[model samples]
Target: MKLKHILIGVGVLLALILVLKFTGVIGGEKTEKVTVEAAGNKKVVETVTASGKIQPETEVKLSSEVSGEVTELLVKEGDVVKKGQLLCKVRPDILQSGYERAVASYNSQKATVASTQQQLIQNQANFANASATYKRNVELYNKKVISASEFDAAKAAYLTAQANLASAKENVTGAKFGLEQSGANVKEAGANLARTTIYSPVDGVVSKLSIELGDRILGTSQMAGTEIMRISNLSSMEVNVDVNENDINRVNVGDSATIEVDAFADKKFKGIVTEIASSSTSVGTASTSVDQVTNFSVKVRILADSYSSVKGGAKDLPSPFRPGLSATVDIESESLTSLAVPIQAIFTGDKEKSPSQAATATNDQSQDKQKAKLNDKNIKQYVYLFDSKASTVKKAEVTTGIQDDQYIIVKTGLKAGQEIVSGPYSAIQNKLKDGLKVEKTTKDKLFSADGKN
Candidate 1:
């Protein structure tokens, strides 16, 4: 009977413990723990990132000037060439025939000019003889030694000779003009023939070759001709990146940048901003319903000397750098030393009352005030300050300035060494409120004045 009574007592004690655990008698409630940080002054350096392709600083797109079949391809891709070196040759038969025709026309006009000059000289001699004959006849007619018809015939002959001389002189002038016109045509034909042979315009490597022997090319005089190849100075390189419109304002010429090429995975090249676009460029298709993103083209020139020695020693990199390689650039935009706080700490809301003020209000009144504040459109920027004495948070309105990667400059409304809630983004943004009780578990890792953690 004594052992049975001890068993009942143990069972009752176990039931009592279970009831206390379920009811709020054992543990009151769970307090939400938060991370807090003290506001201070720090240096913030902002940077912009963009992706682009590697290209030669000076690149020339070679195209044909005269349309013809390529008869000879003298140089292949990767061949080093000097200025005026023959790169390719087109069939010159057609251009040669045209040149020959022009030369023939020019020669014909020259002969005509010579013949007309000779004719003019002969006409002048005849006019002189006819004038002498006419003078002799006029004297004879006066002296009655010659008949009237003979004198009249001599005068007519003189006038006809003069007219013939004038005509011949005009013929000479016309022939000379014709000769000049034909000479111009010959020179034009010769130029066209010269176009059949392509020569390198600059001393550089043949970076690209698009045509093979027997391929036809279009003439640039008529339209944009077929691009046969490209010549680029690989000694100097650049990256062409498109920056979004919003970020372009901070980018300027002469800014320092770090470039990472996809091919050179372990290496980073130093660069400087060389150019920025003034006009915006649209990237997507034109649509009325959807908004298109606008970007500005920026050019960054690679500083080869800066990357020659990596990590205090010359790196023996394999393979040569080539055009069209993908790259990313991080351009340092701005750096500032100012009073700042963690970016997450700043929120947008009206002034929040303290825990004591909130506790004094009725439940319905507090709910109505919260609803009104939520509906209010005139919300201001604020940060939550941890009041250690009350173990609660109060909202402080703040004026802000520029921001960096992890922090923002707080212009006003908060002082240095003041502790504020910094993390658990959800609580700072929505869950945590003014006068809400919170347990401060630990302090956040503070960044140095240089913004380094």
Candidate 2:
């Protein structure tokens, strides 16, 4: 009789629990929990990021101007060099023969000029003697001392001597011209031979070497020759990165940056923006055509203090960084202290309609016109404005300035100390409408000054 009474009591308890659950008692509705914090003044910094290679501030490529077999290579890679130092030499067998030929030709032409000059003097003496004889003969012929034929012979002889003198003067001028031409040829031959002996044009370290002794190379006079080596000023280093066209406009000369080199691992170097390209790079390429990536070349110089502690080259050269090392740069464009909120709180939504949505349902505007209109007033930025008394959230449009990693500066449409939904990103993004109810938990940790969760 006691066991039957216990079974009846258990059935009655289950029925009462089911009744409460089905009615408005338990598990009735769900409310999303979100972290809320008041908007406050904080520092906001805007930065642009790009990846590139580290290179020297000044790197000179050495090429052979005359094609020949490298006979002597005095320097090796990583060797510190001085200005006007002999670096290498090429086999000058054919070049030396050509140079000797040019010198011989020049000497021959000079001797010819000297001989022609002596001939001119001799011709002048002959002309003077013939004139003296002709003058006497003319007087004698007028006095009938000699026949007209004799006077004619003397006159012909004098005229011939004068013509010979004039011809000798012309020969001397031609010979002088030939001498100048030969001189120029000699200089050209010397230059060709000099090119076989390479010399350093600047004081730097040989950062690269492409050839060794007895290597045949091709060179050119009209264009750059074979790149035999490179000399770089390693004390000064810079990172060359390609920035997207979208962010290039924000980067300017003298902007501060932080550089992260892959080889350094965990260490960041300070840098400054030294150059920003005005025009776009790599236009109409296959990759760009497919992906529509437009980039501009930017250069950032690494400050000396950042890498001063790093070891130098074997020769005590100030060269800790190597060319073509992968590096990333973050250029700080702007920083300011202003009223801001958590970056998660800022989001984009459908732009506000000018009239009513129903009124614009049948609007007939061209696609281009509609696109122009949309771009004129770009995507509206908004923050969820929390109404404390009603326990509801409303979207408030805001003009955003710059943003750091964690916080975004709100230019207008919100005031300091105003409560806003700062967390539960999904709820703020998709679920929270103008009149949607929310349980605002005042979690100051969400928007801490250190930006910790």
Candidate 3:
């Protein structure tokens, strides 16, 4: 009976040990190891992305100041023109008549001024003669050579002549002023008449022609027809983009940027920030409301010209880009020269497995400044280092610095040319540890896993 009890106890002990071994609680088992090496420094560029449109930097809209019928159109949509070049002409009959009438009016005023000046000169001469006679009569009256009434009459005559001379001088001055005003009116009319022949105000390409020959163009006014044609300097262009309110604070003038046009997908252009709006507002089309957008406008100067042509060995653009082409732009705000890692490497939770159990571990230094890690903290980061003896993996906690959307700088705990575990975290989590053995997949295996050759 005692021997039998002892045998049963031994059997139970063996069974318990077998269960523990199967559950991996008391014995080691072979695991696919993750080999790792140290990672070196990498250059990281932080950028902000935005959608924008290409536009001409300078656009001039030519319009008629004087109303007239268009008799001829000298330029087309793609024609390049110089400043003050004849663009189009209108019927000159009415303008010519008005100009002639203005000239005649000015000449009449001039004649009137001349006649008034001659009358003023005659009045002055008469006043001088009357004064001399008055002086002679006064002397004679004092000497009793003439009567007192005669001397008084001569003095009155001299005073009347002086008043006449003053009136004539004032008339001459008024006539001269009238003549000058008439001349100015004539010049203004002449200028308006000349304006009927439309001229290019800037050196640019003819972007638009609103009217053809025989179409009457109305005068430029606030309520009436204003635009007749448009000319733009297309040698250099600009990109205007509205950045969201959330990202506006991160943008500034003179930041380096890149632009890609939808029309020209193969080419990428460079630009620089030139202006930033001080205010914010919501903008959208009729189909989309997009309320609470609160976007601010930013203007970028493109470094590449749309046309790369030369005239007489001098580098110049053939034509500037059109005003309304869509573009995708990336503004580089910051860059670092030290170590960088993918943003995915920084994890905020160890929900799958606890950090303590993992062979290759990530020390969470972000928890307590003094302690290497705290179990309660959620934020976690991992990097694998080479395990030389066992040909396996080890992990460490790394402090992080500035980051963009794609990459982040590793402030501490990383070096260059070391292989770190980049993927397959779930498969290797339980078996990870310092100095554990590991095996790495080849590039062909990784590619083939995705069903790619």
Candidate 4:
């Protein structure tokens, strides 16, 4: 009986060893499970995304030049109008009165000029009579036919008439100058009065109306006046977006774009980059803060043919997109096919020696640095490559280029068809060490208890 008990004990011990090996606790199966992807050629397009408002390609802001109440508002917001069409009118009480005063002044000056001309004509006749009388008096004095008193009296009257004629001519010249001054005033007052009547400068819809009937407004001539309304060419639409300064270098005019408007959630509009601002600011407004994020303004014009479905049916209906609808734009700067890997597979490795450093580590300092990678605190970007022969992951330093939504282009240090740890971010980021034993597995299996590939 003692011998049989010993044999049963040995069998139980053997079963325990087999269980340990199966669970990967004390065998070669001990390894971290990680998801891997084979690097391959992929089509990649670099893009820069930005958010902004949809604006008309052509828009004109209307403002009054004369301050007054908006007495006559001919069109409301969203009303379509034509060039030179009457849009609104300001109260013309003060302006009309001034214009009338200028007209009266001009007419009065004209009458004064005419009266002075008549006086000048009479003075000319008087001057002619004075000269003839003076000649006759001289002849009479020479012949002694008349007394000295008569001759002197005639000469004095002739001198007085000559002075009066010269004065009359001077009065006519002064009156003509006054007429010219009054004419200038009339023109200026007329121009100011015309400004009270607003007209559409272009054919468009009134996208914005800032004034109601009888609302008082300041004129632009005096200050930054109230904007009466905005006329927009709705058929021609564009988005004015602010892109990050970091990404603005990748954007250029004539680049294709995909625009997503907040209002049209279901549709994506096609666009082309039309303009790029040379100067950068803090988004819409200028800011002087050192921490402020800089952004460049870019304009993307939505193609007319692409949005025909959303166009208004009749002249009375407004356009589909107003002047300030929110929109997001993705400008595609470039596209190419290159060897790429999932971005998730890459992570910053702590204190690891770079590939170049390790390759040419003949110097003492370089060798020391390579040896201290395990304990050094310096960090650099790296990816884990799967070695099929050893069933392990090797840390590799990689050079990367531009990336899109999913994959990043591997510029160097990687080849096509090579397996790379793609996921189980926790393992790729922290758990996997250089030459660490690893097993291929699905992303979901990385979290399983057994960790089997």
Candidate 5:
């Protein structure tokens, strides 16, 4: 009977222990633990990231000015050339024939001009002789020495000569005009012939060559000509990146940038913002929505002096970087020194009222107004301040200014050295509320240990 009593007592003790464990009577209520940080003054640098390709600052694409088959290709890709260097030659047979015809026409016009001038001189001489003869005849008629019919015939002869002279002068003017027209035609033909022989207009490297021997190209006079090749001055380079519309306003000419190319994995190039587009480029169109993504093109000129000194002192790099290499740029848009906290610490909702309070106070208009005032979207940015004495957190509404990769600038509502809950994102974003019991812990302790909180 005593053994049975002892077994009963042990069983009762075990039941009591299980009840206390399940009901939290022995360990007490568990408080949600969170990492906290002290808001302090620090420099917050704002940057905009963009991807683009490397291109020569001075690049010229060459195209055919006259349509013809490329008969002679003198330069290939990667060949360095100087101004006026012969790059290629197109088949000049057709152009030569047209030029010869123009020359013949011009010569013919010149001969016609000469003939008209000679005829004009002869007509002037005839007019002078007729005038002298008419004057003599008029004087003789006035002296009653010549017959009336003869005087009238002399007057008619002089009028005919004057008319002929006028006609000859007009013919000379027309012939001269025709000669000028033919001369212009000849010049045009000559220009066309010259166009068949392509010459480098600037000193550059032949970065791209699209035409081989015997390839036909179109002329630009009629349409956009076939792009035969590209010549680029590789000594100067630039990166063309597209900036999103939201960040474009902060970017300006002369802003400093850091450029990284895919080819040079370990090196970073320095650049400056050289150009910004005035208009936005549409990246995509949504069929069912009014929202569209737009980007503005920005040009960053690589500083040669700065680029020469890479991370390891510019060793093992190509003499001139090739075009079309993938690159990324980070533009330093703004910087400020202000009281700040980790970006994760700032939450959007009101931390002053718990959900239960909000639900219970719905019938009270004054409480509703207070909730509405706190829930206003315009001033919703806030952080949780840890009340050390009460061991609770209170929502402190804040005005934020700028942010860097990890931290944000607090423009108002928070002071330097004030301790605030930093993370365990869920606790601050969803669970924790005003007057909630909490325990302070470091992020490392909360995340590294498996059973701490």
Candidate 6:
């Protein structure tokens, strides 16, 4: 009786286990699967990716023409100023004093000229009087009515007067020349003084101001000094990017580009390839110091119409885009009217595989197996098409064209309207066959393989 009870208990436990397995309380195999259909459509696109910043193409920097202490800053940074507007003023006191001294000297020279003219007239009058006396004396002597000594004395007096007149005329000429020299000095001093007041060179906003009140500015000379300010046209902008030697050939004038600034997160502006540097402009650095690596600068111009759209009006972008703000850009080098798929879809057979594990098979057999493995479908890029009537997958060979990271253009051997398997490749690898019958499984049946109902 005890043995029979034990046997009955074992049978009951087995029965319960079977029941649990059937109810999905235990693991089991999945019978059905779910599938997605592939649809073909034309995707028109022109896209590329680059990085750059928005900037004023004609950024006018306001710098001092002459060195002086900064006496007054007329405008602060971000002040919208017009062309020829006074933005700042260097200390003009010294310049003014110099100019005044120059004027005084000029006046003094003018007075000297007048005095010289008066002296020249007086000298001429005295010479004339002496000549008249000499003439009278000569007449008296010639008529024998006066002594020879008196005539001689009159002649000596006339000669002395003539010498004095010549000397006076020379002094007058020297004084006049001195006056002209003083006048020129005055004009030069005035020009230097005018240079002290800094002015806006263009119709732009004051983007920068390097001086506060009392900042000494070293004028233009061998040792260039600090700048007063920078003015830029807020409306106009440009981007400069360095193109690699490999890509420089593709980049040309008049190509299209897109720009995005980090400051303005939601904005995208259109630009054009306006200028490409003819000569290479690359400064070598430590990392790039390795011989033979080189790059060239390329400048792009922003289209006004596109900028307006990006700003969402004409006023959003800050005047003279702040330098050092990060930006991204994309230049369209080429485009084609063709069908494309994700680059991940195309797999190359060139990828190397890890060594296989030890098997029941020997070295010679393993070598043979490895040789056969070369012909495996792991490498060749293939697309599986769904045969609607047969309900099976068909392999299609393909040729490919240009690929940007996201998508690749299909060159040939794949037609539109044909559904291709995009996933579950491993599961269907051997079980799937051409003209084989199939039906998509429901969600419940699909997860059944993992023991979930």
Candidate 2 C-alpha lDDT tens digits along 194-306: 99999999999898999988899989999998889999998899999999876787898999999998988868899999998777788545555657678999999999998
lDDT of every predicted structure (CA atoms) = 0.81, 0.84, 0.72, 0.82, 0.84, 0.67
Compared with the true structure, model 1 gives a TM-score of 0.78
**How well is each residue in 85-190 modelled by candidate 3, as lDDT tens digits?**
9988888888799899999999999999999999999999999999899989988998999987888899999999999999999999999999999999899889
Model 2 regions lying over 4 Å from their true place: 1-25, 283-292, 310-317, 350-377, 388-391, 441-453
Compose the digit string of candidate 5's lDDT tens values, residues 1-453: 999999999999999998998887776777888988889998988888999998888889988888888889999888889999999998899889999999999999999999999999999999999999999999999999999999999999999999999999999999999999999999999999999988999998888899889888888687779999999888888999999887899998999999988888888878999999887766343442347667899999988987665544223223446788899999988889879887768877544345455444422443334333432448678889998888899988898877766788888899888899987665675678788989888877887763553
lDDT of 2: 0.84
State how far residue 129 of model 3 sits from its true place (Å).
Answer: 2.0
How many clashing residue pairs, candidate 5?
0
List where candidate 5 sits over 4 angstroms from the true fold: 1-27, 283-289, 311-320, 350-379, 450-453
Order the candidates by TM-score, highest first.
2, 5, 4, 1, 3, 6
Worst 10 residues of 5 by lDDT: 311-320
In terms of TM-score, which candidate is stronger, 3 or 5? 5
Count clashing pairs, candidate 1.
0
Clashes of each: 0, 0, 12, 0, 0, 4
- Every candidate's CA RMSD: 8.7, 7.5, 8.5, 7.9, 7.0, 10.7
lDDT of 6 at 18: 97
- List the candidate 4 regions with Cα displacement exceeding 4 Å: 2-6, 9-12, 15-30, 132-166, 282-287, 310-319, 350-380, 443-453
Cα lDDT of model 1 by residue, 139-234, tens digit: 999999988888889999999998998999899999999999999999999999999988999988788899998998888787769899999887
